[model samples]
Target: MDNHFVPKLTRRALLISTPFVLAGCTTASRETVVTKPIVPAEYLAMYDAVDGEPYPVDAADLTRVDPAFLRREVAYNTPEPTGTIVVDTQARYLYLVGENGMALRYGIGVGKAGLEFSGEALVQYKRQWPRWTPTQDMIAREPERYGPLASGMEPGPLNPLGPRALYLFKNGVDTLYRIHGTTEDWTIGKAVSSGCIRLLNQDIIDLYRRVPPKTRVIVLQGPASGYGV
Candidate 1:
């Protein structure tokens, strides 16, 4: 098992948990559920299918996903003020800092694109059912895959950006990185994506509703609690 800085979780957080096996960044692995996880009823309901949207969202099959990646409220120790967003790329977790040392944590999937941008940034804006356009670098790297769609892809269930997207910016300029939703729920804890951070469609929707424009977001490059840029 790789070494990771486990956060000082609250008793409430610990009581509602199990042995969460962290997956590797290079390859995908099935979580070894030694003891049945005592998942809260509310957590399960949060991922349930939605009734009205631009498209239908299927309920997340928690059985196939690692419990560590599931959304939970944890005791996060960060200097960043409440309402700040922190992304621990190495741990594949994103935290929305809340008052009283608490945070709303979500599992994330990173890739080369996701790792490209790090450090402090702000949520310039957000979009629901946002259109997606492949970057020039992406077109150059995988022409056949992204070339034809250079113009842009309309928002829908098939769109890679999923249903909601939070655009990140630095110095008031677009960083081309985004915190968005993904159709590949199985990839929640993996490092396989064409672009930036991805959360489950259900999870993204929840995050979108919580944060507004200009929200501060800190993307930590290494271990979960590594303060370094």
Candidate 2:
């Protein structure tokens, strides 16, 4: 080969090998470096879930707030406080009266017009993370919507009933209506549920801890006029 051709060929070979050399250097540097932050053992333990597994909640989603929101307090009151709890289906408000002009005001989600009801009732019983059994009507109307979970939907963070449920009863009969928590927080101030009253998980959990069994529950349209006689 000619001298000039030899030099050009050598230069071409070196250029082709440059990328491989740089990649090797980077790999070696990464192996020798200790750049990642170390988490303390105590802090790592705190991050574990209740079941001793890694908690799945996204850290960015956590928020700090006043603890008072977790408690049951009478905020809005009425002069008549002697009847069952009255939920205004149209207005999406729940009223729990107290003595001396005090009531607990809770935001709620009500059923649509054709699905709502106005009547006297009581909270017959309650459940935590209640199992969802779709009614026959619901299955018939939208089999595709519920076919997968036909037997029943298990309780979890994704449950439609977020954390608690209060089953309503009228004259020793279950009305099949519920005042329960919802996974959809955006629906709290709307009429979007089938026929159940939906509350925020935090709110219902707070309410569940406060109310006792067999507490009177009444669902009404618009606003309640007179107290129960």
Candidate 3:
């Protein structure tokens, strides 16, 4: 299945998976803990209310969310061309490669299902406020929750797909994987979705506007290599 083939990251894997920083010296009594980065004031505008959509998108409340999970631009070294999307599953970060050795990175929430789909794929198409239908497997796992919407769930703020969806395909066939948005902003850096890669609603809308159909997307496999950014 050429469309389903999973490609591995050869040289870029280490650089993409490495953490930006891991501070704190170890001591017997005090355990080393990674500190959260401070969120910049400009984020207020970045996550501000989005208008003119099918539905109202309120400004995201980031006070309780992790600063690391907030969207930011950072230095990125990748052989892949600019405009390529590199998703580091292990680090829960998705990098949208940009010019001049930098990328716009977003924190993602990956679920067990997301772990199953890895490798290179293309953004076959994108939809704004796309409808969502639970897979047969998903229905079987939780009939009560998904059975009512077996046909499909309409797009809305409450919809699992949030406000946008980027469908992944291999060899011109649908992979049934998606990079979508979620209303649950707290899940940005966690592994708790049913299977899709989820970003905050605001982030997804931003991403949807940046890339178009046929964009290249690479989902990295395996654990992170403890290298510093």
Best by TM-score: 1
Q: Which stretches of candidate 3 lie over 4 Å from their true place?
A: 1-40, 113-115, 223-228
Tens-place lDDT per residue, model 1, 1-229, is: 1112223335454234444434333325675545444445665676888879968888877766788888877777888877788998878899987667777789998876434578899888889999999999899988999999999999998999989999999999998899999878889988887659999999899888778788889988776443322
Candidates 2 and 3, the one with greater lDDT: 3
Which candidate wins on lDDT? 1
TM-score of each: 0.80, 0.65, 0.79
Give me candidate 3's TM-score against the actual structure: 0.79
Q: Could you tell me how far off, in angstroms, the CA of residue 202 lies in candidate 1 after the best superposition?
A: 0.7
Whole-model lDDT per candidate? 0.79, 0.59, 0.78
- Clashes (backbone N, CA, C under 3 Å), per candidate, total 0, 2, 1
Candidate 2 Cα misplacement greater than 4 A, ranges: 1-83, 227-229
Distance (Å) between predicted and true CA of 55, model 1? 0.9
| 1 versus 2: better lDDT goes to | 1
Per-residue lDDT of candidate 2, residues 1-229 (tens digit): 1211111112222111111111212254547633333333332332222342121221110012111221133444344444336686765777665444445556688887787757878778888778887777678878999777779887777777666898888889878788897656567678898789987665676467556667777677755555321
Query: Candidate 1 vs candidate 2: which has greater TM-score?
Result: 1
Model 3: worst 10 consecutive residues (lDDT sum): 13-22
Using alpha carbons, what is the TM-score of model 1? 0.80
